[model samples]
Target: MLSETNKKILSLAVPAAFSNLFDMIQVIVDMIMLGRVSPVAIAAAGISMQFLGLLYAFMASFSVGNSAVVSRFVGAKELDEASKTTFTSSVIAFLISIPFTIFGVFFSKYVFIFMGSSEEVVKAGETYLSIISLTFPVIFIEFALYSSLNASGDTKTPLKIVVVANVINTVLAYTLIFGKFGFPALGIKGAAIATAISYYISFVLYLYVFLTKKSIVSFYPLFVKDYAKRVLGIGIPAGVERVITYFSFLLFVKMIAEYGTYTLAGYQVGLRIEGLAFMPGFGFTIAAMTLVGQSIGAKNYEEAQKLGWQTAKIASVFMGFMGVLMFLFPQYFAMIFTNDEKVIQEAILYLKVVGLTQVPLAIGFVLSGALRGAGSTKLTLLINTASLWFFRIIPAYVLSKMFGNVLYIYYAMFVETFLKAGILYYMFKKGYWKRQVKWKT
Candidate 1:
């Protein structure tokens, strides 16, 4: 029989995993629907989707900070404090997301310019970016509440909520994109609208859970003054980590762009398909972070370490299997993305290179997730941010400028994944996060 701890972890992991699957179903469906529209549209949506991933990264970071602290409090049986923690985090995320919402909606054209896409790419991406950014507040609030609830051991609620939301998003995106269900065919913008509607629906469902549940946490305006600063303190580092890491990918895209539209388009196809393996790793990472925080909060450092290692092993095993499939059959998968032979060939090479790196990539996610769970976001911030600029982005810019080829561009991704995994494992095994943070709460 499995131990209770193992069983507990799976209870959260299974739902967390499904939520991620639901999230990916939308992406997979989008590629199918939009691929029929035009290769240009597919490429545009693909590149634009990378930028949109920043939204999730930011949400993950905040959720990391929030879940660690909230779970710690809950594990200590401080239910009221835990409730207050979540409510405060949600408010803070809401406030911060508003300006981003405005900028994302109104200034998306500028964002695309920074991304170095062509005129056609810019026009398609800007439309998608603007529409998705409109839902920033909804995204932030839903993420904050859901992460808190999951940490509080209500994992099933968020899973159910996401299932309902993602189904709506997929059906609506398809229907609106194809002029089904009495809807106009709005193309990429229709996908955005579908996503935005789903997020709002998820938020409404989360609100219901927050209000009517067995939660010890509640919204008290005074707690914001008390807990909000700590939340941001932990969050800002995680946020910086994301901003820096993805910026490296942006540089890679820029380098790929110099090779011509087809090359850039190929990289986009490979990337969107590659996202499937990544989602599961992310789910396991979330589980590791939550488990570590709760264990350490209960003064069980050994359990914390065990949780991290086990989750790492699981993620590595899963990603390793995925890496093999991608490595062995890159071209077969490439066909799903595009029929252009040149695009297919370039995509095949890129996929083969990146596929070998997936297990290490999984290790990196696990390490970072473990660090965040221990409330050591500052260390993660410094390491991940510095790596993005120093190791990943700078190298790509140099190689791409001098060599100017797909191989040179993708090398940076390969190197960065290896470096981060090595560094993350070192820091994780160092076990410094076991020290109790003595800040007055």
Candidate 2:
């Protein structure tokens, strides 16, 4: 029998998990469709998506900060403050996206080339990257809205919105990618356009919900300097952390690229399939963050600790089970994305190696989210930077150079996940986040 607390956490987690899964499905659809075009197409889209992920890493800082602040206010019964935070966060996200949009549009070709992609892959990816760049502002806006809603304990609304958005995306992608229903075949460009369109649809829906005052948090036109500072104070460290993390990932991708296009495509496919494990981890992370933030806001430190551990425990079970499935059916999952025998073989290796680490990954995600919720972004930043660079990146680079084998890179990844998870669990037990000062609403 589940306790009430566990029920509340799962009430949020189930919907959020499905939402994240659907979000990944959008990309999986793209990969599957593009795989039919060519392995080069899959590789190109994968690299371009990584760059896009880098851009979203910046936006995630604001989204994360908004979630913490808004949830804290909600817990404290400061509805007005929560609403104001949502608006201000959205504004900041939009403003920050402008320069990134310009940079992405102008330099996407160079970025793909710099990743060591072949000429065909680079050309295939450039248009896709450029089109998606145009939607950067809306993407951030949607993030703000989702964060605000999730913080207010309304994960189901975002789940509904994402469902409709993905439906739109899938239809557009199918029609435009293959010239179905008399639409012109735009290849990779069609996938980009579909994604951008879906983003806009979600953003519009979010904006309407906020404006109509139907959401848990309403939009208000109050922008206090102190409030902005509070959000950014927590956010900037997160932003820096993500920027460094994604930059490191870019470097990792570059190293992977040296292995060849088929290898890169396989890695990308394995990564997407691996999202099955992450979906639950991410959902539980959100639950942990929200519940932890609310508990802290209400000055119930014990409850916060309990919620964090409980969420991690739940996430670990589900993710561990998923890992077992991944290990068992690695080849089957690989075949869903690509028919290339070499690519499927490589993806199978990645899936099998990474599958063993899902429980550790769950621990890391939940604990990190707990820390973030308590406004301990600086600590997380430090942990992520040190663990990622020292444990993951440096070891990976050295092992790859020594062995010249992609399997060694995956081994490094697996080892680093466990190391970081242990450190995060230890830090959570030490209770540093409880001592952190709370923002005044």
Candidate 3:
């Protein structure tokens, strides 16, 4: 039987996992609406949406570090330190978003061009990126508040807010993108607008949690320049790790783009569904990070390791069950996103491929999250970047060359997940991460 702490972790992980599933549903809904226009429209939206994820990649840098610090403080029962870290994290997130926001607004088109998308996709993407970029600071700040709150064991608030926001996004995406509700049909651009508005709504909800709720981390007045570096010390490497991984994935997308529109659309849809499996893993990952960071802060390395493995076990069980559903119901699931037979067939192929990798993916995410909570971003950087490029990206291209099958290409990704999980598990067991970070926060 799970203990009280295990149950507490689930209370956090379940909400977070459900939150990710909602996001995946949101993506499917977006594609279902967009797919009616044309396959090109769907692919264009998917590619641009992905390009925006690059921006999210940057946001994660500050947020990840902030969460690590915040979680540790909470674990240590250091309320003042946690609150101070929250304020510092907000300021740091704002500072980091400035240049990216500017570039996204001014050169949205050129950036898409650089990403090597088609002329049509680039033009459509510029609209999506420009509008979405406007919400970067809002999104990051919202992320900061949510991470801080969740670390304090308040996952329900973020989940509730995100669900409400996604519902707004859903209705607006339908009305604005499809010319319903007497709104101008803005197509992909309309979807971006809806998303931005949702982020604003979420920001308001986060503001409430911090303001109204009695949490360990409350926003404070004193702003310190030194705090930014302290936040970035852990954040920068974590961010760099993500950037490398994103760039590699971006390259993988570019390679797949060369194949055709159907392939890209199928891959895009399948990817979102696949995220559902890993997202449950991600929920536990968040728990692992929070528990480990806080445990270490309390000077309880023994508790940290115990929390880490417990989280991993829960994640594995959940993901394994989800994998069964994914493998068993591929066609039924594919239909939720698109009706195009060809697209559905391709998506089903990727879904089944994902099933085989779900357990490994769970381990990789949960263990890595635990390691990051230990403030060992450099190790994560090396493990993720190396396996991503070596096992997945390179082999994906080579396999596509050999067989011309996207299934074979995804098989390479499966291999990469196992490799990452294996290596990370070993490092985590050895206890090197416990000493790597000297963070005072």
Worst 10 residues of 2 by lDDT: 432-441
The local distance difference test score of model 3 is 0.81
Between prediction 1 and prediction 3, the one with superior TM-score is: 3
lDDT of 2 by residue, 246-352 (tens): 88987887788899998898898898888878999899999988999888777788988999999999999999999999999899988877799999998998999
Superposed by TM-score, candidate 3 places the C-alpha of residue 346 at a distance from the truth, in angstroms, of: 3.9
- Say which prediction, candidate 2 or candidate 3, comes out ahead on TM-score: 2
lDDT tens digits, residue span 1-441, model 3: 979988978988888877777777777788888887666567667766676677778776778888888787787788877788788888877877888789878888886687677888788878787888898788777777878877777777778887998899999998888899788898887888888888888888788767765555788745656666656877788888887888887788877777788888888778767776777887898888888888888888988888898898888889989888888898888898889998898888888888877788888999999988888887888888888989999999999999987777788988888999999989989999877757564
For each of the candidates, give the backbone clash count: 1, 0, 2
Worst 10 residues of 3 by lDDT: 221-230
Note the Cα lDDT for every prediction shown: 0.80, 0.89, 0.81
- lDDT assessment of candidate 1: 0.80
Tally clashing residue pairs in candidate 2: 0
Predicted structure 3, TM vs. truth: 0.90
RMSD of each: 3.2, 2.5, 2.8
lDDT of 2 at 268: 81
Model 1 scores worst on lDDT over the 10 consecutive residues at 214-223
